[model samples]
Target: MRRFNLKEFRSERNLTQKQLIAKTGIPNVTITQIENGHKSLSKELRKRIFDAFQVDERLYVA
Candidate 1:
């Protein structure tokens, strides 16, 4: 199974966690937790991510 690497994607955009938080209005802790696998990606958050990155949601899930 292929897995999406959040770190890589984020890095490719040159967006720091703080920058992502600013762009998406998602809290830093929540973003950190989700990136670290400490929390699941909520539907809202996933949508925000898609909006922020213009990437398909399926890439995030798989």
Candidate 2:
């Protein structure tokens, strides 16, 4: 199954969910949902997250 590596990436970056939300301009609930595998991000949000992490979007998708 495909999975998102949000939590892993965030940990590697030493960022908390709140910090990631602020940096990515994503809602806290959305970040939580994504981390918990309850929701997937929209393309735009994914791009924002990738930019915030300074990594390619593929890093988060599996």
Q: Per-residue CA lDDT of candidate 1, range 1-62, in tens?
A: 23666566679899898888888889888888888988887777778877887877775444
Name the best candidate (by TM-score): 2
For all candidates in order, the CA lDDT equals 0.78, 0.78
lDDT of 2: 0.78
| Over 4 Å off, model 2 | 1-4, 58-62
Question: Residue 20 lDDT in model 1?
Answer: 86
Q: How many backbone clashes does candidate 2 have?
A: 0
Candidate 2 clashing pairs, residues 3+ apart or interchain: none
If scored against the real structure, what TM-score would every candidate get?
Answer: 0.74, 0.75
The weakest ten consecutive residues by lDDT in model 1 span: 1-10
Q: What TM value does model 1 have?
A: 0.74
